[model samples]
Target: MESTTWEESVTDSINTIYLLFSAYLVFVMQLGFAMLCAGSVRAKNAMNIMLSNVVDAVVGSISYYLFGFAFAFGVGDNSNPFIGSRFFALADVPNSTYDYTFFLYQWAFAIAVAGITSGSIAERTQFSAYLIFSFFLTGFVYPVVAHWVWSSAGWLSPSSSDLLFGSGAIDFAGSGVVHLVGGIAGLWGSLIEGPRVGRFDAFGKPVPMRGHNATLVVLGTFLLWFGWFGFNPGSFDKILVSYPDAADQGNWTGVGRTAVTTTLAGSAAGIVTLFGRRLLVGHWDALDVCNGVLGGFVAITSGCSVVEPWAAIVCGFVAAWVLIGLNILALKLNFDDPLEATQLHGGCGAWGLIFTGLFAKEEFVIQAYDSGETGVTRPYGLFMGGGWGLVGAQVTEVLVIVGWVSVTMGPLFYALHKLGILRIPVEDEIAGLDVSSHGGYAYVAHRDEGHPRYYADYMRLQDQS
Candidate 1:
């Protein structure tokens, strides 16, 4: 009995280690997000991009660790309507539940969403205002939604199904909660913040603002794609709740379905975007192509575990279409999306969830209900006449989410605007964040001849207005 008990203890320890490692993979995506922002910003503001990414993750995670975790998972049982309330500062997590593992994983997600907002408002928004938003948004709004979807007791829990309520939304990862919410919030920020000083011409037409480094964009995009493998499939609450007698399948293939669809969609989006940009712009844009891959990944995230192999390819193509259109609209509207957050994460994430409604086989829905089954039968797509019922559910859900985020965020931003604290002083904006906040220059792009002097002249014209 003694020997057997010792072996069992050793095995349990290993299981805990594996779960933690997988969660670590998910955490590293924040670095990927940071790089993506770096790739997207203008050369002059590269430090700004890097700083926002770094600080948002640090501040957002700490804020979440402090209180956000409890708000999302504090409920005592599977049947609670509200988020867990007892875990403020994470005080009550049972030791048996791998306590900090859940905290660690969910915190990564919160950081990612907060990081999404960073890019949208990067160039001109004040770091002080950003710090404020990160505190409230991550610690409150985001956790409340996570509680709704991922928390068992929340109203949208799988066991709490209602067509109108969109319970068990099959988000797989976080199309609605993370990406979509970020995107809508970003849209609001961009709208109320308005374009950067000269992002638009006097005629209100768009002006081109190029990212500093195509190579950085490509590398950052690749990093995000790689990390997504851990993200979508890691949605399995099963990882944390291990069965004592269950068979071990290393890195489960049901999770592979999520990986497969995600990769396929990203690839399809990349190809389509490259060709589309070439056909339209007369030159293929590496940055646009990067966005395409990201767009596809976001598009497939919701439906990844719910769709068939072929459906993934189709989904990717469709998501690319949405991405291209939204990006074009942003430029035309003079929204200076420093990192294209709205089109890539917001637009694609919303579509991905709707795609789940269209492509998810009824059988898969049943499987997701039961917990370990892959629900291969449930992956039937609209091509097979899955019909408008699922489609309608998706449409309604997307509209509600978009409406919920936009309506609330828009007003919040407008109020922030009235207060005049939304942006940094003009001198700070010109100096870049490294010099302004960190007391050092991050990248030497400022070393290029005439950059500061260049911006200085431009600032005078704007201030004259």
Candidate 2:
């Protein structure tokens, strides 16, 4: 093998470090999701919710390492647009350090997809079934969709000759690949698992099942917001390798612009949601605000590197409105999503993709185009005098992703249902999964007299008696 040049070695080291740092930030999202899910359920099921989050990281890591990574991104020339053909069980890579860093980053993304599905079935689903679903989801379902968009050979990606419109689909940070796939899977899971107990009333109106802790929810939301900095900016992957030289300041453009747009979009959505909530219900809800912030993040993710800042604000504001309407509509249609993952991710993710097609600037798109690395030109957006081709491509992606996830996950969940493992026993659910499934309460401060924790403490006190 040829010896590496000093510049190449330095650039590789920098890339690895930056990717790992970004992965760390993304990994922190697991904590945010855990706390968020825990806060969204009743106190009785809090442990179960937190445990599921833990499971996402553990199972997701192993599964992705085994097959998920390979399926999503193959090693060497085995990778194709439709699917990856090698790297099973994480066979050794040629570039161990850099490859491993990339794997770690992608691993975090796989875990996130599983974690997103967990909240929709919270408080009612069986742990065993969720474990199974997570394995397959990361191993296959998610990878297939990811391959279609992120892989160099993907038909819908800029690299493929099968481009549908303009420069093909543009998902700067997985508005469709990550958030949409997760949201659609959650939608199907909710439908198959059915609503949580007492989710609907005798009059057929949706009944609210309020989350136990608002403080935790807000805290989790803040963490997620913080993580978005790494998420949106890190997608460039080019910024990290650029040295701060006179001519190299341009490298910072994508990272800086993405960060700014991400912040503005999230902030704009939060503000819009606050007012929208008041006008609709005469009261503002903390949960709604949190979801609004997340919705905005999802909405701007696809366009953050390509759109102007003002367009980001418009995306966020509209995302809030869409979320509000989508939530109400889901309730009316009997779809139960405790964390509103469906509306926030599904609705906002689609909007992000479409919004990019409308508002993406010509120069920014060109900057991010990476000189046909994906095999397509950086087509301008409609509002930039580019016409409707990009918009059409985005819409096509949205429809294809929705259909793909639904078809794959819907049946899998239904089969799990047939096996009698899809959900816990109704009695177990009513009494709470913590006591019945996990054998403990999440909060002991308010435990009933003779609760298990107290019982355990009492028994320990009399040990050897």
Candidate 3:
């Protein structure tokens, strides 16, 4: 074999560094998920929720390593539009120079997507069953969606002849593939597990089950927002080291635009959610603010590189409304989503894809795809003189993804339910998952003092003693 050139070697090293750093940032999202879920539940189940968050990373990694990467990004003629058939145990993956870093980066994404389902099914789910679900989710369900949109041989890819229309499905950082897929899975899991014991009264009225800690929820939201800088801008990985043509000139434009769009959208959505709640409910709700920030983050993720700043703001604004509307609709429909995962991830995720079709710019889409003018089929936005073709494609993509996830994950949960392991016994649930599942309370103070103490109260007690 011929020796590699020094220039090629140096570029590969830089790309590897870039991806590793981005993967680290994405890995921090695991802590965000832990804090968010732990704080969202009652104190009695906090440990269980936190454990599930950590387990998502642990089990998701192994499962994805076993087969997820293969299904997601595998190559070769055997790799079809629907699924990849190679690298089941990551066999021969080390042969390629770029494979390792890419695998780690995508592994982070798989774990993050798999973690989304944990919150909606929290409080009453069996710990063993959750581990199983997370494994399959990373290994198969999530990878299939990633393959469908992001893989070269994917039928939904703009480059694929099998594509329905337009530029095929643009999901910059997986608003649909990651967020929507997990959202629908969470919805199915929640429906299968049924509501918590007291989620709804006999009259069918929803009861308020407030989270025990608002501080952790807000902190988790901030962390997730911070991590998104990597999520959106790092997706510009392709162009960062591979500006091969004049059309690829100034590729950093897409990266910088992505960062700006992400920030503006999150900020706009947060403002809308915070103030909107005050206007509608007579006071600001911190929980709503946290969810709103996340909803904004999810909404702009798909179009951050393709849309203008103003369009990103619109996406955030619309995303916050979608979140609020879905929260109400879920409650009215008797759905029990503890962290509002369905609304924050599912509803906003679909909106993100739709908004991309409405606002994506032709030049940026060209820049983002890195194939110059020929890379994408229907590159312009509906409002950007591109007409309705892209919009039609986006809507179809959303429906197809939603249908696929629902059909696949719904039955997975149903099978688990039939095995009598999906949900824990009522007595164990009423008693609290921390004690029942883990054999201890999250806070020893609560066990010792017989009542939970606020931080201020704890300080006061220390002073008195």
Candidate 4:
């Protein structure tokens, strides 16, 4: 008995360390978000956007600690399908079922949701509005969605006693829960704010308002890619649990496979986008490829653990077209999102959930959902002959996420707009937020003796010399 206790203690320690490392990796994605948002906007708005990203982390930490974690994972004697009511302010934490490490891991995810939304309204939103929405989103709107899908008492949870359609939605790593929630929220915010000034010409023609630096965009993309290894594989939450039928294999095997699928999906999408954009626009563009890579990652995140590697490649292939097609539609509709947050995270994220419904393997599903322990096999991928139950659940998840975020975030943005605090003024936007609102340009070369046109004057003088 003593030897058994010792073994269990070692396993617990190892799992704790694993979760903490994964949380750290996920935290690094915040830096990636900062760089990506900074690079994707004009240099004038770089400081503003980067500052919002910073605020997302800081505000998200406090809010999630005080309420978001409880709303997302807190359980009580009278557990409900929607929203948690315990552990507020980290009260009664470190219990048997949940620990500090778990809270830290979840907090990382909560911040990521806010980061994704910040990209949609970049360049034109008021900083005060950013703070209000970030706090509300990370603390309330997002946590409700997390509860519905991740909490054991959630109606949509696979672990729920009464599963939706006998197989709850398989958002293995939050394609719907995180990416879709963020994306849909962004969609509402962008739709209400309209396009950024100068994004569309007088006659409704599209204008290419490119970012100032491509190097930063590339750097940010790579950092996000590196962080995704933690985002997907780390969702497993443990690497020590062994499967009953498999000899010398466990969740560790699933973790490795998830990482591989993530890599292949992103890589395939990047390659496809590189060539697809060349054909569409007669030029190779790295920015398009980077967005495509992220889109693929977003799509495959739902099924990274349950789908085969080849299926992941297919997911990426279709995901590239989905992003390309969405971009074209966004341009036609005159809907301007600076980071393509809605299309990449919203559209591709929806596709990822469907892909899971179509391609998830039965055995992998059993392993991922812990159905083997219950001895009750759940429905899986439609194409794999597991039937329509799982696919129906996936479709339901998409529809509900769209409905939920739209209902919640849509009105908040509209109210802010009505109150005249959502978007910046025309003069401020035209002069660039950095000069009019943020006090200075992100690049020092643009700042010359407190004059706005200093860089241009300096250039002309150098030419004369």
TM-score of 1: 0.86
Give the per-residue lDDT digits (tens) of candidate 4, residues 15-62. Answer: 888888888888998988888889899777888999999999999999
Give me the overall lDDT of model 4: 0.88
Error at 252, model 4, angstroms: 0.8
Candidate 2 per-residue lDDT, tens place, 1-465, comes to 999999888877877787888888888888899878888887878989899899888998888888887777774677777776555846633258877887788888888999888888888989998899899898888887777877776777855667657487888888899899899999988989889877887777986678879989998999998888878887776554343233454546578889999999999999999999999989978888999999999999988988889999999999999999999999899889988988889899999999999998877776675531333355778888888888888888899999988889999999999999998887677667887888777888524322344555533432422
Clashes of 3: 0
lDDT of each: 0.73, 0.82, 0.84, 0.88
The parts of candidate 1 lying over 4 Å away from their true place are: 1-15, 77-89, 161-167, 239-251, 372-393, 426-440, 445-465
Candidate 4 residue 11 C-alpha distance from true site, Å:
0.4
Per-residue lDDT, model 2, residue 208, is: 64
The per-residue C-alpha lDDT of model 2 at residue 393 equals 82
Task: Please write out the lDDT profile of model 1 over residues 81-166, one tens digit for every residue.
Answer: 55557446557444674566667777888888888887888888877778877777788777877776677665655545443333
Q: Pick the candidate with the highest TM-score.
A: 4
Best-to-worst order by TM-score is 4, 3, 2, 1
How does each model score on TM-score?
A: 0.86, 0.91, 0.92, 0.94
Instruction: Write the residue-wise lDDT of candidate 3 on 215-302 in tens digits.
Output: 9998898888878887888886654444445634555656787899999999899999999889988998988988998999999998
- On the 0 to 100 scale, the lDDT of residue 46 in model 1 is 75
RMSD of 4: 3.1
